[model samples]
Target chain A: MAIHALIFDVFGTLLDWHGGVAREASRLLAPVRPDIDGGAFARAWRDRYQPAMEPVRRGERAWTDLDTLHAEGLDGVLAQFGVEGLTPEIKRELVLAWHRLDAWPEVPAALTRLRGGFLLAPCSNAHVRLAIAHARRNALPWDAILGAEFARDYKPKPAVYLRAAEALGLPPGEVMMVAAHTSDLVAAAGCGLATAHIARPDENGPGTGEAAPAAPVDVAASDLADLARRLGC
Target chain B: MAIHALIFDVFGTLLDWHGGVAREASRLLAPVRPDIDGGAFARAWRDRYQPAMEPVRRGERAWTDLDTLHAEGLDGVLAQFGVEGLTPEIKRELVLAWHRLDAWPEVPAALTRLRGGFLLAPCSNAHVRLAIAHARRNALPWDAILGAEFARDYKPKPAVYLRAAEALGLPPGEVMMVAAHTSDLVAAAGCGLATAHIARPDENGPGTGEAAPAAPVDVAASDLADLARRLGC
Candidate 1:
């Protein structure tokens, strides 16, 4: 069967998470802690993301959605920065910052083009609610939301990729995983799906890293627009 | 919180399944069984739909998506009508007719309006792939595909409605269930979700049955456009 669907890695692939999170943090924390470096705070919070999910992935902890994990991680980041006295409601609003990330400049148009020829969805580690909020905010034209909640596990766990493919009623070979990260593409390829890499050098910060795939991939593009053109969409 | 999401019952509510299936049957069966009444044949196949799901719902059989159930039902309908000798490839093509359904005339515009104000998805009995195909063909703007596959069970089952709400991280009362079927609304209400009814008088053929709510609902409208207007969208 030919490739009929394209599942994307959401965080750094479609949206500019670093800028969005840092902006939200600045806006939210400015009133209480004007001296805090919002960008540093955002990075510190995100740095814990992988470790937060490890327990669930290892089956040492029961399944929990990313929203809850983000909330827990936010508390530790706040304490690490010596910030305190925030009300529960304020903390809750801040933790939902992930849902408000803005899409990269080329995303909406690229998605609209690719959608003409293939099914599109987010195969991210984010929970369903987070995915829905991001799509609504960014006008992402996804056919469906497939992620951690649907599979009850995070990505790079083979179950996540397999479940997404199964949900589309396609063999792994008939689906392509499109991402900026090599590890995500590698895991997807290991599950028999095709892989495409789109670079996002600023995903971590300028000059800190290049979003090139560490391993060879089937296709490499400068961005989603280039990917769309390469795919002949 | 106010209702933040609206989950729709797709088959009769958004898409004209009756007309779509009847037309596809007429086109596909014309060469093989010219004497068969396509509309009646379509209804016969649909009539077996509920019965086919009973075993899975009852746990007597393992979970199977609607596509497989529909295929099995197609076989029985073919036998009942004395139609035979369809090649496996032809049968597969015929089974996919469900994915090609056209939306009721008002659906796309109304959904566009609704999508502006609320998160939207299909809480249908269809499988995930079937739902995605229907959305693409009909231009229905679903935020996510939540149906049988998500719950691993068919609708009218409390788990289906509850799980759909849970996946969105919203309490039952914060999600509204919109449908043309009274049974579906009733089940959703039982799960503590608000219900809205949209009349689809021709769902079972004009004048044969009215798609009125069997019990009181939060709101009622003649069509999706009317529903969107009533919701202040």
Candidate 2:
């Protein structure tokens, strides 16, 4: 069957959420902590994000929307950074910054090119608003955005991929999941979707080995531009 | 509370499915039947579309997908055109062509711009494949794509819109339904969604008088770009 669509993993694939989140956090914190290192603050803020969500992701707690997760994460970051007396309003702003992260350099052009042939979509963990805001901010041309919120769970859950394909109205086989994280691809692949890995050298540190493992990928490229070419779109 | 997202009706709003279908049918018929006006055949094909889908849309029939509706419409179009010797494969090709129609000129840029301010999505009658294909063909940047296949009913139905908001993890009021057709927006409005009208000149035709009527619209604009500006995005 023809590869009718390419569904992306958004968090680290199209946009660098970690860097963006930190930068926005730092900017918001600048007015309050004139002497605070925004860079370090941003990083610390991001560090708390996942750990905060782990309970929900692991189902130890009931599913929480990212907004709630972000709020909790922000509070911990403020405490850890020794930034005192941060109001709930300011914390909310900091949490919302996740919606304004910048797109990766390769994103806009690669998405445009791929849109020429395949239906370019995203199967992301970001909530619907967050995902849409990120796409609009970066001008990433997505045909349709799919989020974990759509499935009521985060990825590497099979429901996310299966629901995405069902929403796209294509059975599992015709949809290809393009992701930087191998685990996400493995999950999509488990649902019978073809998988493509777009390598991100900057992600997960030099030795993190967080990229999806090699065997699961139907196609792998160094960047989105190369990914587009490899897909022959 | 602010309306954070706008979900659109695709067929007549962003893309002129009727116009495209008519154009393609005419082009296809030109060489073989020089005397036969293909435009009339195209209109005839589209004319049959909604009427045939009425039973399903009205809940008289068990829920059906667009592909089946298109097939039934195709059968009527062939008979009206008096075209003989149509094979099953040729009919299938024509039915699938509905998935590939071109979007309006203002669509891509308008959506790209509006997408900046709100979570822009599609609440469409088309299946996911058709929706994604139309977006790819036209570069329509959607945050999420919701199709009738997901709810198993066509537009003007509350269940479809309700299911969409539920999947979005949102309250119906926070999600706006944007469309050129007033009926879809009216239905969405009844479902407690904020409604916006992106008035397309081409969408205002004789048959559409039935679809467009005065309704309490939350926002009305000439197109998505105008909608974005008015929304202060």
TM-score of each: 0.97, 0.77
- Cα lDDT tens digits for candidate 2, B29-93: 55556566655666677677677768987779987777888888887778777777767876777
lDDT (Cα, tens digit) per residue for candidate 1, span B43-161? 99999999999998998988898889999999999999998899888788778888889999999999999988887889999989999888878788888899778888888899999
- Residue-level lDDT for B92 in candidate 2: 79
DockQ of 2: 0.45
**Pairs in clash, predicted candidate 1:** none
**For all the models shown, what interface RMSD does each have?**
0.7, 2.9
Which stretch of 10 consecutive residues in model 2 chain A shows the poorest summed lDDT? A204-213
What are the runs in model 1 whose C-alpha is more than 4 Å off? Answer: none
User: Per-residue CA lDDT of candidate 2, range A87-157, in tens?
Assistant: 77788788777787887897898899998887666788787667767776787766666757666678887
DockQ of each candidate's interface versus the true one? 0.85, 0.45
Tell me the lDDT of model 2 at A8: 84
How much is A31 displaced in model 2, in angstroms? Answer: 5.8
